[model samples]
Target: MPALEITDLTRLYRRKGGEDFEALAGVDLTVPEGEVHGLLGPNGAGKTTLCKIISTVLLPTSGTVRVLGHDVVTDTHAVKLALGVVFGGEKGLYERLTARQNLDFWAGAYGLSRRRRRARVGELLERVGLDGRADERAGSFSRGMKQRLHLARGLVSDPGVLILDEPTVGMDPVAARDFRALVHELRDGGTTILLTTHDMAEAAALSDRVSLIDRGRLELTESPGTIGDLVSAYERVDARGVPDHVRDRIAALDGVVSVREDQGSLVRVETEQPDATLAVLRTLVDSGVRDVARSRPDLEEVYLHLVGRRGMGVDR
Candidate 1:
C-alpha cells in the first residue's frame, strides 16, 4: 500500500508587508510501505513545508494529500494517529519529566491503555538507549540524549508511518551512528519512514530513495543506487597508490576541483569534467597506480550539481 501521496501540493504565505511568498510550488510525491524515503534540500528548499502539510500542522494553499488512504483535509485526526513526526533540532522535551515519563505522556495522548503504554514505553526506551536514563529529567541530558528521546516519543504510539525531519542534525558522532542504526532497525521491522536531512552522509545512509527539492519545486527523485536514479552524474576518480609527483600533476588538471583521501590511501576526486578526468586516469597506467574506478554518481555529487546551478555557482 502507498503510505503517503501528494498531488499538486502547494503552500504560499502572504506576508504582512503585502508580498506573496510561495513556499511550495506544486509538489508531487509518493512513498510506498516499509522504506526510508528522504526529503532533502538546502535551507530554503521547502522540504519542511511539504512535511508540515502532510502532518496537518499547516494547511496547504492548494493540493491533495492522503496519508494511509485518508484525505489529510478530511481525516486529520485519523491521519495523526497513524503517523509519527520528528522535527529537526531542539524541540523541547518536558524537562522535568524522565525519558520514560515523556513516553508515558504521549502514549496517554494516543489513548493506549495503562498496561500497554508501560510495555511499549519500556521497549522504546531500551531501543533508544534511554533505559539507563529513563528516570533522568530531560533538562540534564546531553544533546544526543534528547534526540533519542525525541525518536522514542514518536514511536510510543507505534504509528505505521514515521516522519523524521533531520533526525540526526546535532548529534555527536557516536550518537548519530546509533540513531541511524535505530532507523535502519525500524525499516527492517516494516515501518515506513519519510525523512529529511541537511547532512549528506545522513541522507545517503538512511534513504532508500531521495527527492531533491530546490526552490519549492521537485528537482529530482530517485533511489540512492542507480546513476540513472539521480538527476546528474559526477566525475569520480579513485587515485590508488599515487606517487607525489603524479598526484600533483593530477590535482593540477583543469577540471579537478577537490580530492578526498579515504583510509589515507585511495582518493575520490571531484571534477568539473569527467572526460578530462578519465583522460588523466589513462596516463597513469604505467606509473604503478594499479587500481582506478569511477562512480556513476551519488547524492553529494547531485547536491553540488543542482546547488551549483541554483546557488549562484556555490557548490553544496
Candidate 2:
C-alpha cells in the first residue's frame, strides 16, 4: 500500500457575508513507502490545509485520505498511529519542560509504557543529537536545538509516515544541514516523509519527487532532476551595449521566448532552444556586444516561472 494516498481532496471554509473559500481543490497525490515527497508553494496556497487534514487535526470538507492503507476519516486511530506530524517553530514545545521530559510526555501519549518510554525517549534524544543536553529546559535551547527536539517529539511513536511542515524554517545553516541528514537517515530506515516548504533549494535537495501546489491546485509533480531538465530547454542570455535594432532582431528570432531591456543598454533574452540561444549570442557578438553571458535558469527561477512570485511565509 502507498504510504499516503489522497484522492479528490477538497476543503472549503465559509466566510460570513461572502462566498466560501476553497482551500484545496480536488487534489490527488500518492506517495509510496519510504519516498520523500516535497510539497512546494507560496503562502495562502493550501499547503497547511492539506497537512492539517492528513494529520486528522481537521476534517476535509470532501475527499478521501489514507495513510498506510487506513482511511483518515474512517480509521482515524490507525492513521494517527502511523503518522508523525512536526510543525515548524517553537509554538509546540513547553517552555518549562526539559528536552527529555517533553519527549517522554509525547511518547507516553503514544501509549508506550514507562520502561519503553524511557528507552524510546533516550534513543530519540540521541538520534536528534540532543542527548548531551537532554536535561536542558526547552525555553533555554536555541532555535535550531528546539527544532531538533520538535523532530524527536514527532518520532516518539516510531511512526511510519512523517509530515514535516517547513521543518527547517528558523534553522541556521549548520542546523539545517544536520536536520536534512537526519531526514535522509529516517528515509533509509524506510520512513515515508511529506515535506512542505517554501525554500526551493531545500525541496530540490531533499525530495525524491516534488509536487507544486498553487491557489489550492497542483501545478505538477516531477523529480527534481526532471523538473530541471524541463526548464533546461529555456536558456537566458544577458548582453550589454545592444542597440534597439539588434534587440528587435533578436526578439524576432525563432524559439525566443522573451526579450526585455534591463537598466540602460543591457538586454536580457530568453530562448526555448539551443539554436535560439546560439543565434542570440551570434547576433550580440556580431553587433560588437562583448559583454555577454549565457546561462540556464535554476530551480528558484523555474519555480517563479510556474508559480509566479509571491511573498514567502507560512501558508494560511
Candidate 3:
C-alpha cells in the first residue's frame, strides 16, 4: 500500500453570501513509502487543506484519505498515530516555556513513558540542533530555530510519515540548507514525507516527484523537472530597442518553438536544444540588438508559466 493515498477528495465551505466554495475538487494523489513528494500551488490551492485532512485535523466533505492503510476518517486514531505534521506559523508553543519543556509536554501528550520521553526529548533536541539551547524559552529563539523545533516536535512520536507545509518559510540560507539535509536523512531512514512549499528551487532540489495543484484540483503530476515538460529546455532573452521584424526573424529559427514578448522589454524563447543559445544570441546581435542576455529556465520560470500565466492566485 502507498504510504499516503487520497482519492477524489473534496472539501466545500459555505460562504456568508450563501454560495458554496470548493476548497478541494476531486483531488487524487498517492505517496509511496520512503519518498519525498512535493505539492506545489498558490494559496487556496488546497494543499494545506489536503494535509490537514490527512492529519485528521479537518473532516473532508467527501472522498477518502488513508495513511498507512488506515482510513483517515473512520480510522482516525490509527492514522494520527502514524503521522507527523508541521504546518506553517506558530502553533501555540508555550512562549515562556523552555524548548525542553515544550517538547516534554508534547512527548507526554503522545503518551510516551517517562524514561522513553527523556531519551526521546534529548535525542530530538540534538537532532534539531537545539540541545545547546535546550533551556532557552521558545520566544527567544530565532525563526529558523523555532522551525527546527517544530519539526522535532512533529517527530517526537517517531511517526512513519511526515507532512511539512512551508517548513522552510522565513529560514535563512544556511538554516534552509541544513533543514533540507535533515529531510533527506529522514527519507533515507525510511520515513515517507508529503511536503508543500512555495520555494520552487527547494521543491526541485528535494522532491523526487511533484504534483501541481491549481484551484482545488490536481493539474499535473510528474518529476519536478518535467512539470514544464512541453519542451526539453528554454531560454529567456531580454533585449532593448529591438524591432518587431528582428524578433520575428529570431522566432523563425530552426530550434525555436515559440517566442512571446513579456513585460518590461523581455522575450521568452522555448527551444528544442540547449545548443540553440549561441544561435539565438548571434541572430539577436546581428539584428542590432546589443543589449541582450540569455539564460536557461529554472523551476521558478516553469512555475510561473504553469500557475501564473493560467491566472491562479499568486501569493508571492
Cα displacement (angstroms), candidate 1, residue 301, comes to 7.8
**Which RMSD does model 3 reach against the true structure?**
2.8
Q: What would you estimate as the lDDT of candidate 3?
A: 0.84
Would you estimate the TM-scores of all the predictions?
A: 0.79, 0.85, 0.88
* Ranking according to lDDT, highest score first: 2, 3, 1
Cα deviation of 166, candidate 3, in Å: 1.3
What is candidate 1's lDDT per residue for 73-115, written digit by digit as tens? Answer: 8999999999898887867589888888888998998999999
lDDT of 3 by residue, 84-150 (tens): 9899876557889999999999899888988999999999999888999999999998888888899
lDDT of each: 0.80, 0.89, 0.84
**Least well predicted 10-residue stretch by lDDT in candidate 3:** 307-316
Give the top-scoring candidate (TM-score): 3
Model 2: how far is 208 from its true place, Å?
2.6
Which pairs of residues collide in model 3?
none
Residue-level lDDT tens digits of model 2 in 185-266: 9999999999999776788789999999888988899997876566777789999888889999999999998888879777
Clash counts for all predictions: 0, 0, 0
What C-alpha RMSD separates each model from the true structure? 6.1, 3.2, 2.8
